[model samples]
Target chain A: MSDPILEVKNLKKYFRVTNGVLKAVDNVNLSIQRGETFGLVGESGCGKSTLGRTIMRLYNTTEGQVLFNGENVHQLKGSRLKQFNRDMQMVFQDPYASLNPRMTVGDIIAEGIDIHRLSSGVKRRERVSELLQTVGLPEEHASRFPHEFSGGQRQRIGIARALAINPQFIVADEPVSALDVSVQAQVINLFKRLQEENGLTYLFISHDLAMVKHIADRVGVMYLGSLTEVAQSHELYRNPLHPYTVALLSAIPIPDPEVERKRERIILEGDVPSPINPPPGCRFFARCPKAMPQCQVDTPRWIEVETDHYVACHLYK
Target chain B: MENILEVKDLKVSFHTYAGEVQAVRGVSFDLKKGEVLAIVGESGCGKSVTSQTIMRLIPSPPSIIKEGSILFDKKIDLVQLTLKEMESIRGSEIGMIFQDPMTSLNPTMTIGKQITEGLVRHQGLSKEKAQKEAIELLSLVGIPRPETRIKQYPHEFSGGMRQRVMIAISLACRPKLLIADEPTTALDVTIQAQIIDLLKDLQEKIGSSIIIITHNLGVVADIAQRVVVMYAGKIVEQGTVDDIFYRAQHPYTWGLLHSILRLDDDEKSELVPIEGMPPDLLAPPQGCAFAARCPHAMNICLNEDPQTQIIQDEHSMACWLMDKRMRTEIR
Candidate 1:
């Protein structure tokens, strides 16, 4: 499309471990438009969260570039980066630890506003109250501490805080995984509402493919730090070319019993290989049902199997 | 198909200084032999307590099975059984697997030792026999490199590996009925699929019924032959999986089904979340607890709790909307 709001090119992050090096995020590329939710789905320790933090520069990437508004975000220094902070905000998965427990809800949301100097005194309070109401919570909840609220309420508070900076983009890292299912639905719809109201760009990271399918316009499937598939939500679900995507989709329990019984199952055999020593070729080869000799010899290059649908599986190649 | 286990008019309450919290209120359901029964509900629905009570696993004083008869194997009433009898039943005739493999496992023990411990102690098998059985269990659960992984600590295994290990340990004695409470909620989608498939395979190999308790509608969708919908400590709906899925009549079931974000649905691109929180169990409404949030709530819904009305075969619901009196009111 036209210049993306955010572009990540061959982003990589490695950790020096006793075993050798942990390749948390391998050569990966993706883009998020100005007002779109780009969902990144993978299991725990698959480096989805690491990727989000890396995009926000919370974790320094060992290699690759994160472009914000066509500018390399990694290169921004001092005052220049401070301005970047004003435009982007983040909400963490664990609400219990994400927000300062000691701080009142009002103070937590206001902390970002004060840092950005977005408003002052009564005006800031009014803005904070407005944000709270927007997320389907009362302004009176602003005075309560994080513990005072239920898991769902606490997440709403976190959402309120993210909106405090009036950010154009938000990195929501597994934002609903820890909450109850019904409450998770609440937080998810809140995100949708917030997106519509603010015209915000989102890098939604989660292991819940079901949740991702609900909010995301486009989804990128990751395995061992590498992207296996990226496609529009409708197209991907309807026609998942990648073996991993097929397995993941089949695995999701469709609330209907008849469909569930009849739904073809793809049971991957082996666990995901460690990122530090991801196999010589495709990360999914060990578990892929359609893996061939070519898959074991070399990693499949990301190719467009259909219009706007991308997959890095030898089956497509 | 006879009832493998029957829970009749179960009432569980935890006595606390704050007051006795009515955790489970006259909840009852039956699990048929060789049939997978899923207890589905959101948090604080008393599914866990009900399952735990069947195992006589609930600690007393603060927690008590205030009233109910848990008929296991058509003869043994678990609620009346003593600690000694419960111990024999556990891991031998009935087994349980909890969520969060990290906490469920013994950190001090190796995977092999932990798995074999239940076999050796409960079944009275020799250590040598138990060790061999443990290895077999590990392999059966599809834990590759099982021989080596058995010696590894819980920390050494990945989350998926650890969960498989938990399954291996739980199935050591091959209990007739296996209770897996939110077993795969903490696992990734791919790994979760593997685990679910493994459970299904194991169940087929050995003719054992499975009871999967989870809030995830997606998880219960596949393996559960029948499903029970719980809310605020009572079963709001119970029926065959087909009945629950396609023709769920209860408002709560409709809300639950609609609320869940399914990966399989294009319509769920924007998941319609149910507004308002579940009622506090300590103060469950005199009428239907879900009446507060029910879109089609009638005036009688707030005045009286509807009886469990049967609709067609094996499907039942508790809601004023389904009550014959409400039908007349609507007319």
Candidate 2:
């Protein structure tokens, strides 16, 4: 789709430990079109967060490339890399730990501005104030510290900071997971408005399938460090092909009792295998209900099952 | 069906530095014998606090049951129970399963040890007897190879398995009432279903009442016979599963139902999210906590609180719109 805004090719991040190299992120490939929200979902420790951070260049990639705007960001150095940093930013998962306690909300959002040398003196202050307003926070909040605001407000501050650099791409890693559900709505709506206003491409990383369905144009399912499925939001939710995706979707609790009672659940067995030593063949084989013998031996390559819908599972193979 | 636990006019508050955080304004509900009662609310609505309070688990000094009586066994007022009395009731008379199983289970101890520790303390059984019972508990929760798995530590078990172990431990005493606070929120959908079904089957087998505290409505459909919708620490709606699902009254309840993002309803619902944020617990609204966000909010809603009105025989709602008195009769 017009070469996609960002393309991930065999992106692998391995960590050497007492055990052999832990393939925390092994051979994951995904792409996000311009102004589209690509949701990356999996249970905790599935390397979804690592994949997001690596894509954002927060963690240096050990293998593969993150092609941003058709340029391999890892290859860049010095000033060019600094400029690239301004083009992309990250919204961390934990609002409590992500914001600097020492810095004021204004200073936190202004840090990127200061680094990019985007403005001078009062102009930077005005820009920060503008950003705060844009994110639906009061201008007076600029003087307040991160500790003063609620978890949701702090996340908004983080979002404002990401937008400070006038970024084309943003990796929001579980931005609402830490916030109260009431405030989660506020922040999610703010994200939608900002997306429409800024036309930003987002790799929205979350384990919450319902939230993903609400925001994302396309959804990508990750298993142990591999991309198992990717499809348009409606299609994936309606007809989930991958066993992992089906299991994940069945897990989301609906708020209505009638619908909740009627919906049959896909109960996955066993825990996600250790990323340090992911299972041979399909990473989902151990837990997948539809897993075949071949699924335990030959890694299922991701293939297009339908128009714009991809699944990597022996069921389809 | 006999009522196992009846919480009446329960008021809980935390004495924060800011002020007394009125967490549960006055929440009340009942869990019938062998039935499931789901307490649904957004965070800070006091669903968790209400459950924890019944278990006498709310941290004191800051947290206090300012006013109300939590009647368990249809007679015992939990607030009146002493520390020693509450300890006896915790595992044997009333079992509680928390949100995160990994943190709930002792990391250093083997699953067997952790499960048996409670039995040794509460049941006053011998170590050998408790160890034997531990295997049965594990198997009861549907964990495979209970013999080998019990010897492993919490880290060795998967999230779902660890949760199952926690459930087994909770069910060890075979308490008459089980309090599970967001038991499956941390688990994935498939694992969540398995846990829900296991709980349902356990409730049927043990004939113990289940009080599930959660924000997800989907879970209530599977387990709950009656649903209690809480808002800003007060019971906004209470009814049977059918009553609340098909004939939901309160605007807050409506907001919650509509907000649930369904895979099928995506095409039907035109991105209509609930308009406003939850009221600040520090300073809840004077009238209705949700009045600020309610689209149908009238003059009385902003100034005077509306008492709950019976919508059906067993269903009720707390909203100005539901108040027949608020409606004027014109000549």
Candidate 3:
């Protein structure tokens, strides 16, 4: 659809640990449309964050290409890299740790503007104030330090900072997971509103499935360092194909007591296997309830089983 | 059902440099034997403080139990207990599990030693006997190869395994009351389900009453029979899980239920977020704590505090909207 704003081809990110290489992101391929929110969902340590960081070039890619606007992000240097920085930005998960506690909110938001030379002097200050208002914060809050605000307010400041560069693509890594439920709703709504207003594309990474469903146009479920399923948000939630995705969807406890009592939960048998020197087949073979003999020895191929629905599982094949 | 714990008109405040911060303002609730009660609220809402007070765990000097009595087992008031008396009650009669298992556990020691230390102190078991019991406890919590895992230190265990060890240590003495403060908040959804199931199984076996303090309504609905909704250092509502989920009266509870993006709800329905932040404890409003955020706030809600109105059997809420006269008048 009009050439995806960002594309990842066989992307891999690995960290060298004391014992062995930890394959955090392994041979992942994805594409994000120009103005749609793409959700990446998985449990902790499942490489969702690593994939997001790799896409944003926060971490150097071990093997593969991150193409932004049809240019390889990993190959960019100097002026091209600076241009890439201005075009792509990231909003981190922990608002408490992401923002500098000592800096004023104005300075934090203007950091991007100053780095990209987008504005200076009164214009920069005015831009910061405008961004604060855009994110539903008051202009007066610009003078205050990050420590003076609550978790929700700090997150708003972080969003304002990301928007400062006027980026086309923003990687929001678990932006609302650290927030309270009520505040999370506010931030999610803000994200939707900002997208409509600014025409921005987002790669929204979160563990909260319900929240992700509400905000994302497309959803991808990742297992240990590999994507298991990808589909339209409603399609994925209604009919999850991968065994890991099905178990994960069933595990989310519904709020209504009656429904919760009647629902049959698929409790996965064991914890996620170690990413370091992961098993030599399907990453989810050990915990997948529908696992077959081939699942233990052969890695499943990613296949488009339905219209716009992709799954990497022997069952789908 | 026999009342295992009764807290009446409990008030707690922190004597801080920014003046006395009234943390828990005149809250009260009761827990029955073998019942699972959940305290649901956002941060700074005094849900944790209430649990800490019940366990007699709040640090003093800066913290003070200004008023109210916590009657545990209908035998003693925990508020009046000295540090020595509370110590005797802490691990033996009541156990606590925190959100982060790593911090709660001693990383320097082996998992077996940590679990056995409580047994040795409370049950008067010899080291050898305690070690044997510790392995069994580990197995009970669903840790594989408990015999070998026990000898390894906390660093060797994964987050889920570490939490299981914490649960084993907490249940070492078979405490009648177990307080889990957001036990699954730090774990993954799958791991969270495992922990919740483990707690349910253990509760049935040990016959211990549980008080789970968390912000997740889904978790509360999954494990809790009764629910308490707290806001701005006060309990806004308390009822059976069905009543809270199906027939919630307080506007804050409705806001909370509506705010969350539930998998069962209509995908297109816009989430109705409560408008404002929680009231600051240092300068709390004279009226209802949630009035500022409530969409249906009336004039009386802004000027006067709403008393707890008994809505039905085992259902009570502190909101003017639930008052019979107010409801009739509004309709």
Candidate 4:
């Protein structure tokens, strides 16, 4: 648990829009252990994607630093930066949009391999076929375009592309959300299998709580560009400390009719407040059911409330 | 209870360049008066096509209705109704709420006009009367400051609020039957809860039967009284909520139930996902659509499409495994 592969310290990624500075990701701090899955769960526009991208060094950090194996990712230069790129990879949300239509499935998967100069000639083709079979696709599928495949198959191709470079870490952003439930299960199982077989670390980001709970060893709940709670998978679901986390968990509709009928859903009132010049205190102060008077004026300090459970709320303080 | 809408032997096909995509094949279901019926299926299963067909919204050039009848209120056949007749019935007799609120609502026009347009056209209310009624409708859908919010355009509202506006627009005339095609699919889970609650409240108050098309089993369990499970453009199972969730018979429904990650599932428990993709509707398989993916598929399942078998009152499935002889053979 102490062997952290990556650490994000006070990371902030902001955009200077016409209206004001859009605080997409503000002062986020978390670390991913070696060979451990860290799940980031949040609503749309909460900056979970921005955080993932920032850590991947796709976006220049506005403040703070991202350390990969105790080395500053943002400060990397020349050969070090190129090595960093080869070490980390990303799987996007939409398989249809992320994949290039004009390119064959083999070319798409081998794009990373070609850039890294990992293999060439017949060897490169062999590697691509191996990747295709690894992701449960036929080796013949290498010649076909992405359009020929189903949504689930297209997603498999996307995963194959990510695994082409054999990166130590992968940021899977809503990887299974676009696929159907049955297909999603298959892809999730594939992800788990890949992690075990390759000893890879993952930053699994999604809006779906149930998916996050299933794949994540440690789960972090984000709201309005800030993390509200971070706990072990079972602990967070069993006893969520943050009010926003409680509401988020309660809001997820359980599939069982009996459970749905009996459970009291804590539907959060109003929409998420604008991230542009967010309120003085807690961002969730307005919609929070258990909001204190101080919550409106003072920001909550991020604290380790329990042995492994961390929360950023005045109530816990 | 009486059925507000009944669809019989419905088949819809889209003539694309590749081939005639049989979007919906012999789908049959009924919605009881004042009851919420959920059509649950994955994308391209014809759930959306079935709902759009109810409003006669499917364009006939590329898409054609091969054969079927959509009987509304036990008197009017929506399938036979012309575009002109559909105009009169749409929003007045039957209304629809689309999946994406962002695209469904007109961006150029104010939400107030969008809501009032339906009331004025459908109910024949005067402009002034419609505007006042629109404000009430807006408030009913839980939009704060309806007076001000109504004046604003669709761009001004959030995703959740825009969906509320869409619901308000749909319910403006208080149609007898409402077809919400994935109404909450685009919104956040918390907002989804709010919209589901609003729909439940409005259904009770308006006494309108609803046909909700969605793939989320959780959403189905939350609001729907009855469930219709579709696969490869055909309904595999139809039953009460309890029947579908607890005692489902179809292999597809079982796969769907087992695939999802349950909140209470054991941490180490592996999901039992259906291995294969849904069969292509272009040249659909000769037999049961789900036979390709079903673990319990028999020789007959691959050769013949099973007839709808009645398990109990209001509980039926179209599966060869449900046959008495097959069940005994399996045992």
- Candidate 3 DockQ vs. native: 0.81
Tell me the TM-score of chain B in each candidate. 0.96, 0.96, 0.98, 0.98
Off by over 4 Å in 3: none
TM-score of each predicted structure versus truth: 0.95, 0.95, 0.98, 0.99
Local error of candidate 4 at A283, Å?
0.9
Worst 10 residues of 1 chain B by lDDT: B262-271
**2 versus 3: better DockQ goes to:** 3
Predictions in order: lDDT: 0.86, 0.85, 0.92, 0.93
Pick by lDDT: 2 or 3, better one? 3
lDDT of 4 by residue, B1-331 (tens): 8889989999999999999999999999989899999999998899999999999898998999999999999999999988998999998889899999989988999988999998878778999999999999999999989999989999999999999999998888889999999999899999999999999999999999999999899999999999999999999999999999999988899999999988766665797788988888999999999988889888999999999989999999999988999889879
Prediction 3: B-chain TM-score: 0.98
Every model: Cα RMSD to truth: 2.0, 2.2, 1.3, 1.0
Docking class of 4: high
Docking class of 3: high
Total backbone clashes of model 4? Answer: 0
Clashing pairs in 1: A253-B218
Instruction: Using DockQ as the measure, name the better of candidate 1 and candidate 3.
Output: 3
Residue pairs with colliding backbones in model 2 are: A251-B189, A254-B218, A255-B217
